[model samples]
Target: METMLITGANRGLGLEWVRQLDAAGWRVHATYRDPAKAEGLFAIAKKSHGRVVPHQLDVTDFTAIDRLSVTLKDEAIDVLNNNAGILPARKKFGQTDYDEWARIMRNNLFSYMKMAEAFVEQIARSRRKMILCMTSGLSSLSAAGSRGTASKFGDGKHVYRTTKCAVNMLAINLAGYLAERGVIALSVTPGWANTEMGRADLDPGYSPDDLVDPVKSVEGMRRIIATATIEDSGRLMRWDGSTLPF
Candidate 1:
């Protein structure tokens, strides 16, 4: 069975991914900032028997990441999904909170690099080397300016958008570096899903069944990660399984 590691598994999209992947017979190493707060996940793991294991990880901590790396050193991780991210509560550009901005960048972008860097050797050992970075459509310069649907989230949070934009470049650069080694590093937008940070009235017109529910989205992402080939590396993809503009 293929093994995978997911961050922010306590709630929202991360928890759903754990459920779907566990059901599919994948060995899931799901991390939460505090395992004590992951009651919901613990309940789900009870049902999964032993396929899922809860991990305590604060992605910003390099020491913790390195420690986890050593613990799972023997396991070959097929996919590393950097799904944990933060949305700014306030949206004014000049009125930004430096601490909040720093936190978002740490969790959304920097931690991804740290995790991949620390675990690259483990991923390299896997038969199918894949890394999935979850991104937002709001992060796209084209989508942000074109008024092509993603513009609904008005500007002001320069910090959040900038961090995601950085993630795009990070994926591209990493893909280039890993290309020769047969590793696939790709960025994907999960569409406008109804997560805790999303607004109430903003709907993508996708049905509840069709919408990017966290559980369904993870399954879709797993399939995409599984099918990745040299030809598909370095591309930006959507949850609908199509390439998106950088």
Candidate 2:
């Protein structure tokens, strides 16, 4: 059976990914910042008959990451989904709070790099050889300036946008660096997902089910990842299965 280790598994898209992958028969090592607060996740894991294992992880804590790495050292992780991200309050240019921006960068970009560094070897030993980074359309420079540029669900904020852009660069850089190791690193934008970090409306005009359901996005991502080659690495892609410009 394939194995996936996902960060941020307590709620929203992360929780849904755990559920879907567990149901589909993959062994899931799902991490949450506060496992004690993860009652919903624990309930699902119980329902899954042990397919999901809740792990304690705070991405910003390198020591926590190292400890988890040692704990799972014997296991080969087939996929590493870098799904943890934060959206600090929005601001533009000089008005952007440096501290908040740095926090977002640390959580969304730096920690992602640290996680990949910690687990790349485990992934290399596995057969799937894929690493997926969750990114956003806001990461696309081409799309950033367009009118009606709000996220598909209508909430467009600058802090989230800038961090995702950084994430895109980090993923691409990893893809290039790991090319010789036969690992493919790619970024996927889950598109206007309906979560706390996403837009709040669930109108008929919006396909909130498709937008919010991490299962669908993940299944699509699986197909894309399974078919990936060195040629496909370092690309920014959408959940609808389309390529986006970096």
Candidate 3:
């Protein structure tokens, strides 16, 4: 069976990925910041027999990542899903919270890079050497400037958008860097999903019908990841497997 490691597997999209991937027969190493709060993931793991393994991981902590790397050194990881991210409380340009902006950058962008660095060797040893980063459509300069359909999500989420944009760039750069090693790195947009963070007050306004279901979103993204080839490396793709403007 293929082995995959997913960060932020406690709830929302991450938990859904764990459930779906485990059901699909992949040996999943699901990491959560707080395992106590991951009762849903734990229950899924209990029923997974040995296909699902939950590990404690705070993506923001590089030392913890290093420790986890040491523990899984002998294992070959087919896919490293950099899925842990945070959306800070919104603030306009003039009222920007520098601390919160830094925090968001750390969780959303830097941590993804750190995870890739920590596990690149294991991914290189696998059959499908891939690093998938969960980005956002809002991060695209073209999508953000769209006045028609994209405007429905509202504006002024500078910190979140900026961090995701940086992550997209990071994925492209990682793709080029790892190409020689046959590791494909791509950034994916999960669309506007109705997750806890998606519905948070800081999030852009969208109706219940406008938001995609977490299960549907993860399912689409999983298909994209599963079918992605070396030619698709460094591309920014939507959940439906269509390419999006960078």
Q: Rank the candidates by lDDT, best first.
A: 3, 2, 1
Work out the TM-score per prediction: 0.89, 0.89, 0.94
Backbone clashes in model 1? 0
Instruction: Name the better of 1 and 2 by TM-score.
Output: 1
lDDT for model 3, please: 0.88
Instruction: Return the TM-score for candidate 1, rounded to 2 decimals.
Output: 0.89
Highest-scoring model, TM-score: 3
Total residue pair clashes for candidate 3: 0
Lowest-lDDT window of 10 residues in candidate 3?
A: 145-154
- The better candidate by TM-score, 1 or 3, is 3
Q: How many clashes show up per model?
A: 0, 0, 0
| Candidate 3 residue spans exceeding 4 A from truth | 145-154, 201-205
RMSD, model 2, all Cα superposed?
3.2
Cα shift from native, residue 239, model 2 (Å): 1.1
83-165 per-residue lDDT for model 2 (tens digits): 98886665545676778777778899889899889998899998887789999877887776222533432243667777888
